[model samples]
Structures are given as C-alpha cells and as structure tokens.
Target: MTTQNDAASALLDTSSQPTNLRIAGDWTLANYKALKAQTEALVGHYDGNTSVDLSQLGALDTAGASLLVELLGAQRLGQLAETATHLPAASRALLQTVYCSLQDFCVPEKQPEQSTGVQVLARIGSAVDTLWQDTKALLGFIGLILETLVRVLLHPKRWRMTSVVAHIEQTGLNAAPIVGLLTFLVGAVVAFLGATVLASFGATIFTVDLVAFSFLREFAVLLTAILMAGRTASAFTAQIGSMKANEEIDAIRTLGLDPVEMLVLPRVLALLIALPLLTFLAMLCGIVGGGVVCAVSLDISPAMFISLLQSDIGVQHFLVGLVKAPFFAFLIAAIGCLEGFKVSGSAESVGAHTTSSVVQSIFVVIVLDAAAALFFMEMGW
Candidate 1:
C-alpha cells in the first residue's frame, strides 16, 4: 500500500502540472495559468480528482469554461460532489447552465411525428372551438363597454368631460376639411356626368335636381362614412394596437384604469357626435361644387341652381342622409375599436388589425347603406 505522504505527493505532482480550464471573461491567460498552477498543486496534495474553487474568481468566460468542460468531461464530472464546500453558488450555476447548453449544441432533440389527415381535422376542430370561445369573449368585452357607458351616464362625476370634448373636436372639426374636399370633388363629377347626359336630351336644367338628390340623399353620407372608415378607423386601430404591443394596456389595467373607458369610450362618443356634422358639411360642399359647375359649364347660374335645388329636393333628402350618418358613425367607431382590442400584441398584429378595422368598417357601412336604400325605396321615398 502506498503511504499517505507518498500518495499526497504524487497527487500534488500530477495536479501541479498546468492543465487548461477553458474559462472566458476578463481574465488574462497568465492569471488563468497561475490559478491552474495553484489549483493543480492543491489537487495533487489530495485525491487525484477534486472540485476546483471558482468562488474567488473575479472573472471568467466561455473560453475558460470550454477548457474546463473538456478537462472535467462535464458529462462524467459535472455533478460530482464538491471537494470544496465554499464554491460560489453563482459560479456553479453558471457552469451547469453552460454545460447543459453545450450538451444541447452537441445533440439535437428528436422531432414529434407529423400530422395525418385525422390529426389535421382534429386540430382544425380544436382551432374552431378556440375561435368560438374568443368570439364569445369579444362580445362579452363589448357588453362590458356598453355597461360602463351606461354607468358613467348615470354617474356623470365618473366621466372625463375634458377628454370627451376633445374627442368630439378631433372627430368633427379636424375631419371637416377632408370630408368637404372629397364631397366637393364627388359633386363635380356627378354634375359633369349629369350635364353630359341631360344636355344630349335637351334637359340640362335637370342637372341641378340630379346633383341635389344624389349629394343630399346618398353621396355625401356614403362618402363621409367611407372617409371616416379609412381615416379614423385605421388611426384608432393602430393607436390601440401599438399600446397593446408595448404592454401599456396591461400597465393601465394594473393601475386600475379601464382601457375601454380611457381609450374606446372617447373614440366612440366622438364619432357618434361628429359623423352627422361631417355629413351635413359634406352635403353643403357638394352643393357648392355643383353650383360652380352649373354656373361655368351649363350657364344655369348659381342662383338658378340653388332655386331649383330648393324647389325640387324636399327635407326628406337631408333627413335621409343625416339619419344614415349616426348609424354609420357608430358602426365605424365600434368596428375600429373592436379590431384594435383584438390586436395580439405583435408588430404583425398591429398592421393586421388596422387593415381589418378599415375593411370591416367599409363593409359594414356599405351593407347598412344598401339596407337603408331598400327600406327607403319600399317606403316610396
């Protein structure tokens, strides 16, 4: 049997030989060499295998760890009991994590089986069920919003008066110029078309009636709604989607603020108030454009155009346009806010919802307009 002194000396001699411990980070090679020399001498005095103390190591890196991993055969020695109990928990944990990652890099995991027809159908069914559940959730969300609105109406002190007023101004006043310009252009086109057709039939005087009827009864409201759908709807969706992506909505909730109250309510109320006003302004600009066309092109004169419009078009035309305005307003606002709330907190989601908001609003407005037209026609309007 070897004497303890001889064994210790042999162990010390073996350990004292410089062996690389592939470590990395702010340590010089000379520092690593010195540490290895000291560690080797200590290890040689004891058992041939011993845990190296890294607790006092001021710095380390992957280069150093890679060397250590190679020396220790991390697979075989990573979990061995510590010879030194004073090793830092941080250093040990770091080493273990690095070792595990290295193992993963060396070996890829097995893949799951590919789906068959039956499995694909099963997945689709599950997806449908999930979608149905989400639909119910979205409806419930809208209900909660309406309930909040009712509660606020019942308790005025709970409402933000300044915000509501500001929203109205934005939805109404800021939108006025675009609404006006679009309607004016539409009216000019309509008047030109009517003049060309009527002039052929020697009925050029009827151009005023055509302009008045189309603009007041249909074009103004429809164009205004579409504009709002494109402008305000996309803006609302993009704004809310950004907030969702940044986790600002979560922060608001944590702060006990209802995002619906802060974000959706103002927009909805603003649209409800603004759309009718915009419609009326659109009609005015359209008539003005028609008058200009008649004056220049048809020699009908602005006074004659206004007189004919007044005599031929009844209050019913204005009433119909205004009636559609509020409905379209509510539709645009609701769809925009709904799509915004649907955003999934990703960059792609923001763009998708913004597009969806505009598309949905336009579809709804057109559908509603068609239904309204059918109703008006049936009533012999």
Candidate 2:
C-alpha cells in the first residue's frame, strides 16, 4: 500500500525462554527484499513457544502479506489474523487470503520412469497407430480421386485438355533429359560391372544379357518412378500448397468449382500419360548406354549387342517394367496433391507437407514395385 522507501524489519528476541517475533515498518513491495532478508536471519527462532506482535507493522500489500504468512506459517496465520486487534482490517484479510491459498496449493507429482521394454512397446504402438491413420487417409483420397475421375470421364465437356497438356509438358517433357542422363549413367555402370565379374569366368559376352534383363525388367521403371517421386511430387505439393496458402483454393470452392477437378485432375491425368512414356524412354536410353559401354570396353560392336539383346531378352521383361508405370504415377501424383491439400496455411506447413509427400511417394512406389516383382517371380513370369 505504501510506496515509501522505509525498509521493513522483523525483530526476534532469543534471549527469553520463548521467542518474541516483532514486525515493523512499511511492508510494501519496495521493502520486500529487506524484509525477506530480516525474516531469513531470524528463521532459527521459529519454535512452538514463539509469540508474534504485529502492532508496530506499518502499511501492508499482497506481496508483503504473502511474506508475513510465510514467516508465521499456515498453522498460525488464521488465529493470528483473528487475534491481532492492532492490525488493520485490510492487512488481516490479505494475510488470511495468502495463507489459505498457499495451504491449498500443491505441486504436480513427477511421472515414474518407464522400463526400456515399456518405452519400446509404446513407440511401436504409436507407429502402428500412425500407419493405420495414414493408410486410411490414402485409401479415402484414392476413392475420392476415382469418384471424380469417373464423373469427369462421363462428362466429355468437363475434360481439362489444356491443363492436362500443360502439366504433361511440366512433369514429363521437361523431365526427360535428366531421366535419360541418370539411367544412361547407371546402365553404363551396370554393364561395366557385369563385364568385370563375368570376365573371371570367361563369360564377359553375357554382360549384354545382364544389362538387358536388369534394365528392361527393373531399372527403367523403378528409376523413373523414384525420380518422379522426388522431382515431380515435390513440385506438385509446392505448387498446390502455395495456391492453398494464398486462398486460391478456397476462392475456387466458393465459385462452385471443385478444387480436385480444377487443380488435381490435370496433374493426375498428365502423370498417368507421361510416366509410361518416360519409362519407355528410360528403357531405350539404358540399353543404348549399356551397348555403348560394351562396344567400347568389351570390343563388342553395337550390332552384336543388339543381336544379343534380341535373342536373350524377351518381350515379357519389357512388359513387366512398363506395367508398373501407371500405378506408380497414380500414387505419386495422388500423394503429392493430398499433402498439398493438408497444408495448414503457413510457410512451414507447406515445407513439412512437401517433404512428407516426397517421402511417401517414393516409399509407396518402391513397396508396390517390390510386391509386383515378387508376384511375377512367384508366377514364373
């Protein structure tokens, strides 16, 4: 209550058999530090026989009242406030309030430590729950995409040819050079390594068969899909996420437009058409690269490499790789667009969801490819 610079004092007389604790001076915030120090110095005098005299106590505020309650202890606060006829009504009320509040306060209990096994189990359970949720989301999105696709297909006028063509240029044509270059380099490496290992057994010529079978059956589509996942998927997520963050998506919805149709369909259709073409291009590029390496390193002419591939590699190998393209493309495009729609209207949300899209697309492509490969192998394809 008082703003005066008067330092509060708590005096104790330990000379008598019973301690006498006296409080005096302005007990406001400004004197809190001094008063605290004084009380702390006389803490040893707190015993059952101690008697408090607050008659000389000056102005009091909540902060000082709190300190007084602490010095008197909760057990004696109520009784002292009631008996202290010299203390002002406001001061006594404040002391009682602080004392009651402090008595009711409780510190939260610390959690017990878990055993290693318990921690591990908790982590596994959490992972399973997350996986289940993700699976449900992906499946639901897929159904939504399928429904929209069917509706569009039924209405020829609803076809987004311009958007589809534009997206194809962006996702496929623009991507061809990098795809070709990577597959060519990887094919060369595969051919060279195969020749080196085969030479030990005097079968280096069979390197052509190794490269042909590997690239046509696995490398071409797998590599193309993985690249698209990282490159094209991230682009789709970022573009859609940016649009969503800018409220363009909401505007589209308000205008009676389906965002999935306006934004997602073109991208999905374009990828569907583009990925198969890219996979085919990848196959041709890979074989040529292997042929080049064979012509240079093994002294096997290009014609000879072609002849070997024609005889040793069957059409089924090519079909096996190309068949996986549509599935991969669908998943990659869907996952990318799905993540974009999930952005929470922030730059950081856009970034996090973009990264998540890439990871999910790549993982799905690889897993589906593996399962397809296993099915083919089991069926003697």
Candidate 3:
C-alpha cells in the first residue's frame, strides 16, 4: 500500500534519448488527485516517439488507467502493450482496452457559416418540408376519423349519444355568447364604416344593404368559425391531450376500445350539429346589430332597414355562408383531435399542441372559405 505522502508521481527524463517517461507507485483512487495534476502537466511535453515505462507502476485501477491513457494519447498508450510487456497483467490489459475504445474517436467538425441569402433559402426549404409533413399527417388523421365514423355508423349500438350531447353543449352552447358578441360588434363597426363612406356619395340609405350583404355572405359565418377555432379547438386539444398524458388513452386501447370512436367521434358529431346552428345564430345577431347601428347613427327606421334588407339581400347569400359551416366544423374538430393525439406525455407538449390546433383550425377555415367564395363567384352562384 502506497502512503499519501508517497502518492503516485510521473518523472519525465528528456535527458534520455526518445524522452523516456517513468511512472511508479500505486496508480489508484487514493493517489488520484496528486497523480492527475502530475499527469496533466506532463502531457504537453510528450511527443509521438516518447517512450512510457510503466514497469514499476503498482496497484492500477480504471481511474488511474484512464489518467495514464489521457497523458500518453491512445495511440502511444497502445504501443506500450507490447513494448512494456513487463507491466502488471491487469494494468496492461486495462490500458489496451481503453486505447482500443478510443482509437477511432473523432472531434465533431464545426458547421460552416452560411450567407444571408443561403440561410433564407434554407429556412424556406425547412418550412416547406414541415408543412408537407403536417399536411400528410393531417390527411392520415382525417382518414382515421372517417374510418372510425363509418364503423360507428354501421354499428349504431356503438353510438355515444350522451357524450355527443355533452360535447355539443360545451362546444356549441357554451361558445355562443362570445361568438355572437364578437360578430355583433363587428357588424356594428361595418355598418358605421359603411354609413360614413356612403354619406360622402349621398348614399347613406344604402348602409342597410351593405350590412346585410356583408354579414349574410361573409362576416357572420367567418367570425363564428374563427371563434370556434380559437375556443373549441383549444378545448378539444387540452381535453384529449390530458387523457394522452395520463396514459388513459393507452388504457382504453388495452381494453380493446377504440380511442377515436370513444373520444373523437362524439366531439366531431357535436361540432357538426353545433356549427350550423351557431352560424345561423351568429347571422341573426349580426344583422340585428347592423340594424340597430343603422337606426341609431344613420337615422334609418327599423322598418325601413328591414324593408331594404328584404328587398336587396337575397336568401342565397345566407345559404352560401351557412353551407360552409359543416365543412369548417369538421376541419376544426379534426385538427383539434389530431393535435391532441400528437401529445407526447408532457405538460409542455399538451400546451404546444393545443396552440397548434387553434392556429391550424383558423388557417384551414379561412383558406376553405376563400376557396368556396371563389368557386361560387366563378359559377356565378
């Protein structure tokens, strides 16, 4: 046993040819602190041809072997296996093992700097790739929902009527006040802006037609869908995401229950039933708001406003907006549930996916609405 005062040490003899370095004493944890400092100081002095003589080294351990390997470099340490065959069997074997393990090691190369234009192009390419992946995933999720829906329809006994009703109340009934209020305010603002602009051309009386046309054809349904996207979609993601995080979804699968049918179907059915009804309510509230604004600001009587609305704005405009509700509902529900299923058993994942669900649902609704409007216009509908 080497005493603390006689701890491990290394002697570098540059006076000798090939710069012979001798290591002696117990190279174990008890002497590691002193050994480490001595070994590190000697490392920079040694070259590839430097000879390491470990014949006198005593009581070697993994810690000491690693320190010696670090000092000699793995290649030089490997050469010692044959040249210093007089070393203890355990020490020589440990050195060889460490050297072999480190033989093929390499430092990672630094990334090259990219020009601004190249960076911008790279970012664009990455965004496009991500969008493509998301589109494929969404399409796959939609297919799963459709398949589950078909299975449920075929076996009417699997219908979750109670869950559907509860979700309808949550998504539709609970969401009505905010949706109605937002659309009403928007309608009032549109009416005020219309009256102000038209008054310049002495066409203030046309403000009623402006409000009716805009709300019936675009604002009511668009605002309602956007509201549902933000509110209902986030709710769906959080609810389902929590289930996923808790492994309740996994347990459902283990019991031979389809998570899509039990969880997703009810939400989808509820939204389908709720969105059209909500769109109609929004349209009525918005028109009423516009009518109120006309009476108050433009001095148009209620009867006159209604007469103008009835005479100028056709029911076809109302039908056009209402027709988009089911599509928007399906997409919003699908996106929310899809994001929920993407949760990775973390609170952060739930929050992140919930936000994604809202953004995607709103984006899909707006894009689909624009496409629908263009199609209708092209067909002169």
Q: Pick the lDDT winner.
A: 2
Per-candidate TM vs. native?
0.66, 0.81, 0.85
For candidate 1, write residues 1-381 as lDDT tens digits: 111121111112234434322222333243555444443444334432433333334444554555455445676435631432454565556667776886677566788877698789999999899768755765676687788799778977778878878878877899998889988988888999999999999999999999999988899999999999999999889988898889999999999988888998888888888999999999999998888899999999877887897788899888988899988987788778888888998999999989988987888899989999999989988
Instruction: Per model, state how many residue pairs clash.
Output: 16, 0, 0
lDDT string for model 3 (1-381, tens) is 111226677888888898888888888988889888787677578787777678778888888878877788777878887678788777788888888888767788999999999999999999999889999999999899999898889998889999999999999999889888888888899999999999999999998888888888888888999999999999999999999999999999999999999999999999999999999998988888888999998899999988888898888999998999999999999999999999999999999999999999999999999999999999887
RMSD of 3: 3.9
Q: After superposition, how far is residue 270 of candidate 2 from its true place, in Å?
A: 1.9
Please give the distance, in angstroms, between residue 219's alpha carbon in candidate 1 and its true position after superposition: 0.9
Return the lDDT, model 2, position 91: 87
Residues 128-154, candidate 2: write the lDDT tens digits.
Answer: 998899889989999999999999999
Lowest-lDDT window of 10 residues in candidate 3?
A: 1-10
- Sort by TM-score, top down from the best: 3, 2, 1
Report the Cα lDDT for residue 230, model 2.
Answer: 97
